[model samples]
Target: MPDLLVEHHGVQVLVCSADGATIATEQDALDHLVGAAFQGAELVAVPAGRFDDRFYDLSSGVAGAILQKLANYRVRLAVVGDISHHMGTGTALRDLVREANRGRDIWFVTDLNELTTRLAPRP
Candidate 1:
Protein backbone atom coordinates (compact mmCIF):
# COMPACT_ATOMS: atom_id res chain seq x y z
CA MET A 1 0.00 0.00 0.00
CA PRO A 2 1.10 3.52 -0.72
CA ASP A 3 1.02 6.60 1.47
CA LEU A 4 -2.26 8.47 1.53
CA LEU A 5 -3.48 12.02 1.91
CA VAL A 6 -6.02 12.55 4.64
CA GLU A 7 -7.63 15.43 6.45
CA HIS A 8 -8.29 15.75 10.13
CA HIS A 9 -9.81 18.81 11.79
CA GLY A 10 -8.97 20.81 8.64
CA VAL A 11 -5.38 19.67 8.68
CA GLN A 12 -3.92 17.94 5.63
CA VAL A 13 -1.99 14.89 6.67
CA LEU A 14 0.10 12.50 4.64
CA VAL A 15 -0.59 9.17 6.26
CA CYS A 16 2.01 6.58 5.48
CA SER A 17 0.93 2.98 5.20
CA ALA A 18 2.20 0.63 7.87
CA ASP A 19 3.40 -1.67 5.11
CA GLY A 20 5.18 1.09 3.25
CA ALA A 21 8.91 1.44 2.91
CA THR A 22 10.86 1.31 6.11
CA ILE A 23 12.49 4.56 7.10
CA ALA A 24 15.98 3.78 8.29
CA THR A 25 18.12 6.58 6.98
CA GLU A 26 18.17 10.34 6.58
CA GLN A 27 17.55 9.95 2.85
CA ASP A 28 14.46 7.88 3.50
CA ALA A 29 13.24 10.56 5.87
CA LEU A 30 13.82 13.21 3.23
CA ASP A 31 11.85 11.20 0.69
CA HIS A 32 8.80 11.22 2.92
CA LEU A 33 9.22 14.89 3.73
CA VAL A 34 9.43 15.83 0.09
CA GLY A 35 6.41 13.77 -0.80
CA ALA A 36 4.35 15.29 2.00
CA ALA A 37 5.41 18.82 1.09
CA PHE A 38 4.60 18.20 -2.53
CA GLN A 39 1.10 17.21 -1.60
CA GLY A 40 0.70 20.34 0.52
CA ALA A 41 0.31 18.28 3.66
CA GLU A 42 0.54 20.09 6.96
CA LEU A 43 1.66 16.97 8.74
CA VAL A 44 3.02 13.51 8.05
CA ALA A 45 1.54 10.59 9.97
CA VAL A 46 3.89 7.65 9.93
CA PRO A 47 3.07 4.34 11.51
CA ALA A 48 5.59 3.27 14.15
CA GLY A 49 6.04 -0.06 12.42
CA ARG A 50 7.28 1.74 9.33
CA PHE A 51 10.40 2.84 11.15
CA ASP A 52 13.55 0.75 11.40
CA ASP A 53 14.65 -0.49 14.79
CA ARG A 54 17.55 1.94 14.70
CA PHE A 55 15.06 4.74 14.94
CA TYR A 56 14.18 3.68 18.49
CA ASP A 57 17.81 3.53 19.54
CA LEU A 58 18.76 7.05 20.49
CA SER A 59 22.44 6.31 20.14
CA SER A 60 21.94 5.50 16.46
CA GLY A 61 20.94 9.16 15.90
CA VAL A 62 18.44 8.16 13.21
CA ALA A 63 15.54 9.67 15.13
CA GLY A 64 17.32 12.93 15.78
CA ALA A 65 18.47 13.30 12.20
CA ILE A 66 15.06 12.55 10.73
CA LEU A 67 13.19 14.74 13.21
CA GLN A 68 15.60 17.64 12.89
CA LYS A 69 15.31 17.53 9.13
CA LEU A 70 11.55 17.61 9.30
CA ALA A 71 11.58 20.49 11.77
CA ASN A 72 14.07 22.39 9.68
CA TYR A 73 11.67 22.10 6.77
CA ARG A 74 8.80 23.24 8.98
CA VAL A 75 7.00 19.95 8.43
CA ARG A 76 4.98 18.62 11.34
CA LEU A 77 5.16 14.90 12.11
CA ALA A 78 3.08 12.41 14.07
CA VAL A 79 4.48 8.97 14.73
CA VAL A 80 1.30 6.92 15.01
CA GLY A 81 1.41 3.65 16.94
CA ASP A 82 2.49 2.24 20.26
CA ILE A 83 6.19 2.55 20.93
CA SER A 84 6.19 1.37 24.54
CA HIS A 85 8.58 -1.43 23.72
CA HIS A 86 11.19 1.12 22.75
CA MET A 87 10.70 3.03 25.98
CA GLY A 88 12.44 0.93 28.56
CA THR A 89 13.20 2.10 32.08
CA GLY A 90 15.36 5.22 32.14
CA THR A 91 15.55 5.19 28.36
CA ALA A 92 16.46 8.23 26.30
CA LEU A 93 13.75 7.26 23.82
CA ARG A 94 11.18 7.80 26.52
CA ASP A 95 12.59 11.21 27.33
CA LEU A 96 12.64 12.15 23.67
CA VAL A 97 9.03 11.11 23.21
CA ARG A 98 7.99 13.13 26.26
CA GLU A 99 9.78 16.26 25.12
CA ALA A 100 8.57 16.00 21.52
CA ASN A 101 4.97 15.60 22.61
CA ARG A 102 5.11 18.89 24.48
CA GLY A 103 5.72 20.71 21.20
CA ARG A 104 3.61 21.18 18.08
CA ASP A 105 6.39 20.23 15.70
CA ILE A 106 6.56 16.52 16.53
CA TRP A 107 4.39 13.98 18.35
CA PHE A 108 4.23 10.30 19.23
CA VAL A 109 0.63 9.20 19.35
CA THR A 110 -0.95 5.78 19.86
CA ASP A 111 -3.32 6.00 16.92
CA LEU A 112 -5.09 8.11 14.31
CA ASN A 113 -7.77 9.04 16.80
CA GLU A 114 -5.16 10.57 19.05
CA LEU A 115 -3.64 12.37 16.13
CA THR A 116 -7.04 13.69 15.23
CA THR A 117 -7.56 14.99 18.75
CA ARG A 118 -4.18 16.67 18.64
CA LEU A 119 -4.99 18.27 15.31
CA ALA A 120 -8.25 19.71 16.58
CA PRO A 121 -8.44 23.48 16.54
CA ARG A 122 -7.07 25.09 19.64
CA PRO A 123 -9.09 27.65 21.53
Candidate 2:
Protein backbone atom coordinates (compact mmCIF):
# COMPACT_ATOMS: atom_id res chain seq x y z
CA MET A 1 0.00 0.00 0.00
CA PRO A 2 1.09 3.56 -0.63
CA ASP A 3 1.53 6.29 1.92
CA LEU A 4 -1.86 7.58 3.09
CA LEU A 5 -3.42 10.42 4.93
CA VAL A 6 -5.52 9.45 7.92
CA GLU A 7 -7.38 11.14 10.71
CA HIS A 8 -7.04 10.18 14.35
CA HIS A 9 -8.58 12.07 17.24
CA GLY A 10 -9.37 14.90 14.82
CA VAL A 11 -5.78 15.28 13.68
CA GLN A 12 -4.68 14.56 10.16
CA VAL A 13 -1.64 12.32 9.84
CA LEU A 14 0.42 11.08 6.97
CA VAL A 15 1.10 7.39 7.46
CA CYS A 16 4.11 6.18 5.52
CA SER A 17 4.35 2.71 4.05
CA ALA A 18 6.66 0.36 5.91
CA ASP A 19 8.08 -0.94 2.65
CA GLY A 20 8.82 2.46 1.20
CA ALA A 21 12.27 3.77 0.45
CA THR A 22 14.46 4.14 3.48
CA ILE A 23 15.05 7.66 4.79
CA ALA A 24 18.80 7.78 4.98
CA THR A 25 19.52 11.46 4.78
CA GLU A 26 18.23 14.92 5.65
CA GLN A 27 17.01 15.40 2.07
CA ASP A 28 15.01 12.17 2.28
CA ALA A 29 13.37 13.34 5.48
CA LEU A 30 12.63 16.73 3.92
CA ASP A 31 10.91 15.00 1.03
CA HIS A 32 8.54 13.24 3.40
CA LEU A 33 7.89 16.43 5.33
CA VAL A 34 7.02 18.35 2.17
CA GLY A 35 4.78 15.53 0.97
CA ALA A 36 2.95 15.41 4.28
CA ALA A 37 2.50 19.15 4.33
CA PHE A 38 1.12 19.11 0.81
CA GLN A 39 -1.39 16.51 1.92
CA GLY A 40 -2.51 18.72 4.79
CA ALA A 41 -1.11 16.44 7.43
CA GLU A 42 -0.70 17.81 10.92
CA LEU A 43 1.70 15.03 11.74
CA VAL A 44 3.70 12.32 9.99
CA ALA A 45 3.90 8.70 11.16
CA VAL A 46 6.79 6.72 9.75
CA PRO A 47 7.55 3.09 10.50
CA ALA A 48 10.74 2.93 12.47
CA GLY A 49 12.17 0.49 9.97
CA ARG A 50 11.89 3.08 7.24
CA PHE A 51 14.53 5.15 8.96
CA ASP A 52 18.18 4.34 8.37
CA ASP A 53 19.96 2.61 11.26
CA ARG A 54 22.12 5.69 11.63
CA PHE A 55 19.05 7.59 12.81
CA TYR A 56 19.01 5.55 15.98
CA ASP A 57 22.61 6.37 16.69
CA LEU A 58 22.81 9.73 18.42
CA SER A 59 26.42 10.29 17.43
CA SER A 60 25.45 10.10 13.75
CA GLY A 61 23.19 13.15 14.15
CA VAL A 62 20.68 11.94 11.57
CA ALA A 63 17.76 11.86 13.99
CA GLY A 64 18.48 15.27 15.39
CA ALA A 65 18.73 16.85 11.97
CA ILE A 66 15.54 15.30 10.68
CA LEU A 67 13.61 16.06 13.85
CA GLN A 68 14.88 19.60 14.03
CA LYS A 69 13.75 20.30 10.48
CA LEU A 70 10.28 18.97 11.26
CA ALA A 71 10.06 20.86 14.52
CA ASN A 72 11.16 24.05 12.80
CA TYR A 73 8.07 23.78 10.61
CA ARG A 74 5.90 22.87 13.60
CA VAL A 75 5.25 19.46 12.13
CA ARG A 76 4.92 16.65 14.60
CA LEU A 77 6.51 13.25 13.97
CA ALA A 78 5.71 9.78 15.28
CA VAL A 79 8.13 6.92 14.71
CA VAL A 80 6.14 3.71 14.85
CA GLY A 81 7.60 0.22 15.32
CA ASP A 82 9.49 -2.01 17.72
CA ILE A 83 12.89 -0.47 18.42
CA SER A 84 13.82 -2.55 21.45
CA HIS A 85 16.96 -3.73 19.74
CA HIS A 86 18.08 -0.17 19.15
CA MET A 87 17.07 0.83 22.65
CA GLY A 88 18.98 -2.05 24.20
CA THR A 89 22.11 -0.89 22.45
CA GLY A 90 22.59 2.05 24.77
CA THR A 91 21.16 4.32 27.41
CA ALA A 92 21.34 7.35 25.09
CA LEU A 93 18.83 5.84 22.67
CA ARG A 94 16.61 4.65 25.50
CA ASP A 95 16.71 8.05 27.13
CA LEU A 96 16.00 9.79 23.85
CA VAL A 97 12.97 7.60 23.29
CA ARG A 98 11.74 8.24 26.81
CA GLU A 99 12.13 11.97 26.42
CA ALA A 100 10.61 12.15 22.94
CA ASN A 101 7.59 10.18 24.11
CA ARG A 102 6.94 12.77 26.77
CA GLY A 103 6.72 15.58 24.25
CA ARG A 104 4.00 16.62 21.80
CA ASP A 105 6.38 17.21 18.89
CA ILE A 106 7.91 13.76 18.64
CA TRP A 107 6.98 10.28 19.83
CA PHE A 108 8.43 6.80 19.62
CA VAL A 109 5.75 4.13 19.76
CA THR A 110 5.65 0.38 19.36
CA ASP A 111 2.93 0.40 16.69
CA LEU A 112 -0.03 2.16 15.14
CA ASN A 113 -2.22 1.08 18.03
CA GLU A 114 0.03 2.82 20.47
CA LEU A 115 0.16 5.86 18.20
CA THR A 116 -3.62 5.92 18.12
CA THR A 117 -3.79 5.67 21.87
CA ARG A 118 -1.36 8.51 22.27
CA LEU A 119 -3.33 10.69 19.86
CA ALA A 120 -6.63 9.95 21.53
CA PRO A 121 -8.51 12.75 23.21
CA ARG A 122 -8.51 12.84 26.96
CA PRO A 123 -11.03 14.26 29.39
lDDT of each: 0.87, 0.88
Q: What is the Å distance of residue 18 in model 2 from its true position? A: 0.8
**Per-residue lDDT of model 2, residues 77-97, tens digit only:** 999999888877779999988
Model 2 stretches astray by more than 4 angstroms: none
lDDT for predicted candidate 2 compared with the true structure: 0.88
Clashes of each: 0, 0
lDDT of 1: 0.87
Residue pairs with colliding backbones in model 2 are none
Q: Tell me, by TM-score, which candidate is best.
A: 2
Superposed by TM-score, candidate 2 places the C-alpha of residue 16 at a distance from the truth, in angstroms, of 0.5
TM-score of each candidate structure, all chains considered together: 0.93, 0.95
Name the TM-score of candidate 2. 0.95
Candidate 2, RMSD to the unseen true structure? 1.0
lDDT of 1 by residue, 1-123 (tens): 787898899989998888878899888988866555668888999999989999999898999898888888788999999999888745699888999999988999999999999999989
